[model samples]
Target: MNAESSVGAQPTASAPKRFALPSPARRALLRAGLTGAAAVGVSTALGAASASATPTTTSRNRPGTPDEALRELAVGNRRWRTFRQRHPHESPAVRQSLTSGQEPFAVVLGCIDSRVPPELVFDQGLGDLMTVRSAGEVLDEAVLGSVAYGVLELDIPLVMVLGHQSCGAVKAAVAADESGESLPAHIQYIADRIAPNIDRTKEGDARVDATIDANVRAVRAALAAEPDLAAKIATGELAVVGARYELSDQRVHRLA
Candidate 1:
């Protein structure tokens, strides 16, 4: 079993399509809230729009400007690096509140690596961030739809592609590309996703770190090319940034 096995055995070729839906009770509650709040001014109505939005697999914490959201994530990561995790509320009140809905501040499309959990790295509590994880941080139709929900339905301002150092998947891709090793179908799938970027970054002086950075850039580019995300970014409603976390430092550097 590799690092991604924990996220569910490399989503088999026949892996069932996952779907997300809000609890009926929660949907009712949110609908009620929206109806009540819509009577207010346009600004207030917009605020309630996010708060009362139906929960989906891609739920966000709240509405914020791109810079504000980025700052919040950066500050959270600082706490994590220093082992000063705020360990915020995961209380019954919080759970019950989200029972009605969520308003996450940012959307994180990241790798499924256990060490790079978004909530912990960002020091965000329950209902704080909309997170999507995949091996190598690769994307497909469903993942794009998930990101779209974050931007269109949830009004999240920032979409981050979180990569990490010592990424085993990246290492595997580098090995397979170099040695022409026949990887298992599952591992091969991940390798294929990351291989092109690895090749592009290589000058016959490739290293795992370089490959990992390349993977980050590739996924970031993929997100940028997403039509829904592109439109939101063009309109200033969202920003997609690449980030790589250093395991030793536990700090995430924003890729330029």
Candidate 2:
């Protein structure tokens, strides 16, 4: 299904305008100019590949707008939760097409939790998304720069900072903050990054869940404020969002 139809949720009145794809000229110029500006980083990200091997034809045509990308994700999530996944873009031709290069439509920054793999949760296929993972969906220089490469080089329309229900990283942070014990090594680093986003006033799983949402929001805000990503947002070429995956229901919910 096309992104326009896959929106199982109701679309906003102004949403149509937001989903409009950039013109061919605008898209090309955007690819050229932004690619040049971020050439070093993009080159670092794609060492041997020649730009994006993705042609603008056929069904593999990635979503062209933030809303459309979001809608497609929502639809894919629905398919996942319902056990109706189409499993799109896994074909041999699609695989061969991507051998040239990739042009992902969205950047999904998700937790390293085993239960919440973004591709399966979103029911997307190869080359459909640029997936980055860290504990608690935490951002490090490498993680953030990887996401930025997708946006600045690939002109990806959406960036989703995906948190999840019962996030273990956030739980560790909550427990560590409560017990006054430091997590060891890089685990401590993850907890430290997550701790500030938690509210120390609450207790138990409720606290951890709340902190999970908070971390997603904080990450979303941080990415939105990033200079290069923010430039794309200002021009209406990109959107940064927060979402949560529920382990029990096997559902992904966009955070309000």
Candidate 3:
């Protein structure tokens, strides 16, 4: 879905009521590193909504702010981990309605790992989350531009970089770096982007794991620092966060 498209009916239905998280819990999440503040200066510029309230329905239930977007994702991930997914917005009516226009709540930049599909991992459906995937969560002009389009054009409130435990891209990068071997074709491009941020000192799975999180953080920082997105973040209109998904436990951990 192109947020830049100028032709369509933009729905103005107020975002639906969602699962509200209390203040103390929100503070605990902050401390626990489930979110970062604007997530760096994120705490200051925000408007009054501090709670993590999540949506429970179709596109009509838009999450209008960063906290709301984060809340819905948290709820979706929880449903995924607990095996209680609502599978919201897969209905034909929801699909048909989206044909006229789209108002997604968040933009998710995650790894291309088959196991870490953004929609399934977050338990979101069509028109709910705008997704962009690259191996190891690497960034490039096109990737950055896609994210910008969501925040600047669609006014989407959140951007999340999801890195999972035991990511193969990071694993491959570590292997290549350690062996002094070069990756072939476009794979080398991916490795080169990740090479600087990779923690080569750690061995075995530790190195790959560290790189996985590091790559996510790097991507998160890059998106947060993008000039266009930074302005919206200043007004509390958007937020960029880093998270790690543990495949073993089926839980998604938000990073600090």
Per-candidate alpha-carbon RMSD to the true structure: 11.4, 7.7, 16.0
Per-residue alpha-carbon lDDT of candidate 2 for residues 125-230, written as tens digits (9 for 90 to 100): 9888899999999887778767876876677888888998888899999999889998888899999888778975667778888889888877777777666666
Each prediction's number of clashing residue pairs: 8, 0, 6
lDDT-based ranking, best first?
Answer: 2, 3, 1
Angstrom error at residue 85, model 2: 1.1
Q: How many residue pairs of model 3 clash at the backbone? A: 6
- Where does candidate 2 stray beyond 4 Å? 1-59
Model 2, total clashes: 0
- What would you estimate as the lDDT of candidate 3? 0.72
Estimate, for each residue in 1-256, the C-alpha lDDT of model 3 and write its tens digit: 1122111111122211122222545534543452233234434664322211223233476889888888788889889989998898889887666644567898999888899888987899978888999998888867876676566556788888888988888888888988999988899889888877787678788888888877777777766765566667777777877788999988877766
Each prediction's Cα lDDT score? 0.71, 0.77, 0.72
> Model 1 TM-score?
0.74
User: Which candidate ranks first by lDDT, i.e. highest?
Assistant: 2
Which has the higher TM-score value, candidate number 1 or candidate number 2?
2
Candidate 1 residue lDDT tens string, 1-256: 0121111011112212233433547645655665456435534745433334655334334447777787788888889888899777487776666645677888898889999999999899987788999888877666866776667667788888889988888888888888998799687988887777775545443577887876776677666665566667777777877788888888887765
Runs of candidate 3 with Cα error greater than 4 angstroms are 1-59
Candidate 2 lDDT for residue 204: 77
**lDDT, candidate 3, at 92:** 87
